[model samples]
Target: MRKNKLSFQERAGSLQEECLCFCEEASREAMFQAPIELPEGFVIDPAEAVTNVTWNADSLSCVSERCFIETGPEPDEIAVQFAVRLQGTVTLLVSVSPVRNQYGQGNGAVSVIHSAEIDQVVYYSDEPDDCPDFSDIRIENLVVVPPFYGSPLSVTGTIVLVPEPDQRSYVFTANSGDSTVSVIDTEVNTLVSNISLSDIPTDLGVTLDKAYTYVLHGNANLVSIINNETLTVTQTTPLAGAPRKIQFETGGEFAYILAGGSSIYEINISSQTITNTFTVSPAADDFALDPNGQFFYTTNSGIWVVNKYDIKTGQLIDRLSNLETPNVIETPLIGDFAYLENGELRPNVVSVIDLTTFSKSSQINRLFDGLITIVFSDDGTRAFFLEPFPENLTVVDTAQHTMITTASLPGASDIAVTPDNQYIYAAQPDDNTVTVYRTSDYTAVSVIPVGTGPAAIAM
Candidate 1:
């Protein structure tokens, strides 16, 4: 049987709301904003493209179930063509801005613009999938159709882009009390390995290549690199001042470690040798880098503030205060904002730092007091707050700075979301297990047993 492919053709600068008018320069998955001119000669063509594009004042990560083709802009106006892969009968939800420039810059915000359901069936994929067939048909001139308010279970009908499972299928947790690291495979919800370490692990991070997992021991003042293939600690680097967090460059070319409460040690990946050292405010044990590794943020408890520094120029960019503790700082993959937990001895607050203007935009204080830990979804649309009021979880809508949902699960210490945005894995130390909750309904789907006293989690 021959498949009838849907071909998309759009005119530049003024794209129809129905076409795939997404602009991504760094990665295939783009967080797009209209009227924001993109660089010239932007291009990418692959055998299969699954793009999760975000647009608007408050942003979101959205993806369709089908595959798409790349479309570059013309000189003046933007034109794009998308060949979407289909199977049976599928409904796609898309938000398009009224295009305004040749660079596919949208003039207006991407308000919820949904297209009506199409009724056509065709041969979608050459092979079969475990999931149901949604669409595989043919259509033309897919101009602006009637607005579609889709399925209730779809969560505002936003097509959630699922990342490649082969690369990010395992959730890593650090059991500080047990001095061991447990690897949980999300595919089967089973414990793959309980790696016993020599020292208490404080934090964990996986390399970009998925080749190794780096474990930092703050008390022992050393780092252990575990080879994922062997599930064994292959190499160990001893450091001073109680090393805290481990970060990698985008290409896995270099690694940076925060140690001694006031220094960042940079290591060349190829040689695993100390390439350079940089100093920061004393008593600052935690630091975070922007997604591109161009900027860094560190907390200075001496003044109870967080400082943003330009990594290239080694100059301060902005400083944030009003925090009681100001010990921890984190940024999302999109690099638009920073999340800092506040009020260790006071009220629990999470300050949102606007990266563009380098200022404090808003503070989320709805969470309960005691201890607050937040983990952002892949696209920055949502954040999971770990509240210590007898162990509970709160889901906040990042765009509106509103609480979306809540779950009371006793013993939940820390939380980490899957790359696909489908599930939340919370480390329950009180129960000596990790609870898996479905993002769609906040239901506990699985409670897999893990090592004791799980304190931290990473994807």
Candidate 2:
């Protein structure tokens, strides 16, 4: 049966409220009176003690609108030294007049200056009796952009921009603690679907070929293979114990489940069941598969590298121990080497594993207090970590294996990298906010609110 695919679109900007305007204008006029009779308490300061004096006025014809001015004793010639300023009680004045021609033709003469210095000014209007015209005007515009709001849940799991036929990116999130998956319309930045699952899902791995998604249920002790097309649970394969991490092989025919002890469940996609189980020496919390499917790395009580067997033999080829505490093991896409982030204190480390030798060649430590999640960039040039508890995401340059940038997450428990490598979404379990950051400059763009205890983030 053909499936009806929903279109997902990317949002241009976040949601916000409408902006307000700010245009206003005040009128003008001219007048001359008794200095606007001062009130009982309006006594001016002594002229000798004044440091500054200012005035403004509007004028028309013979009348001049004057603003009150007071200043300390100064030179009589400096009466025009009043300062210029703005206030609700102050205004400017304009004066106009026509002057008479010297050849006995009558015209008006006009002069303008600070009202306080009007006595020092002179007007030579040719037509002294003629009155010209004058007018006054005042003008004001408003500004517009709104505020951004997000969900309340700490974003755990991943967000993928699955391009739909309609040109939208279908956004999805996997919550480890909530044990629920949220589907969002990227274009609208709105939640459209929330899929409920079993106990805390630690890992989410999706495959488009078979239209199935494998979820490692950390507390449920099972691997849920969900049908992506139908958005329904197709099968739940029982594992040894808590399956904290799971990944699908490149061929898309088999899946690997890493559980509590030193065992890993190898399930067959055809039968939708666990066909064989491989128990390596030490136990592991997570595992990663080499893109080539020749070798798989699991973080046991230490760390172990196991070779793929022919069938249900459940035999391991090579394993390494006494290494650093390993959390998530991933193989960078650009090179054959693998990267591991140990989520332990004191000797917290990240190691570079040579796939061919199955040995740790180089390692860096104390990069952070705890690094439980590590994600490589799309091009495999950089790697990211979700340091739990003291919530923060740190990015490292893969070539140098050195720390590059760090972002504070506060109650952050997990992080997810978008397929495009544009944003890193971090989940804060206590704060219940998913912070989105730009990967290039590592600037915080937005904080998305979500439900309580967001435990995982993926994309």
Give all candidates' CA lDDT scores: 0.61, 0.52
Off by over 4 Å in 1: 1-168, 248-252, 269-271, 312-318, 321-325, 343-345, 365-368
Q: In model 1, how many backbone clashes occur?
A: 13
lDDT of 2 at 110: 29
Q: Report RMSD for candidate 1.
A: 19.0
List, residue by residue over 1-459, the lDDT tens digit for candidate 2.
Answer: 112221221111111222211112211222221111122222222221111112332432232221211111111101111121121222222222222344534433322322321221111122324222222122111111111253211101111111122333434456655677654444455555556665566667655253666777777787776665434556767776887666677677887777885677888877887777887655656667776766566665444333333224555666665465566578764567777765446546777877777777887533656566677775778787766654366777878777777766666666666768887776666776677777777777777665446666544
Candidate 1's TM-score reads: 0.59
**lDDT string, candidate 1, 4-106, tens digits:** 2233432332344444344332121112111222233321111221222232212221223232222112132222222222222123333333423456443
RMSD of each: 19.0, 28.1
TM-score of each: 0.59, 0.56
> After superposition, which runs of candidate 2 have C-alpha atoms over 4 Å from their true positions?
1-171, 176-178, 198-202, 208-210, 302-313, 322-328, 342-345, 389-391
Q: Give the best candidate by lDDT.
A: 1
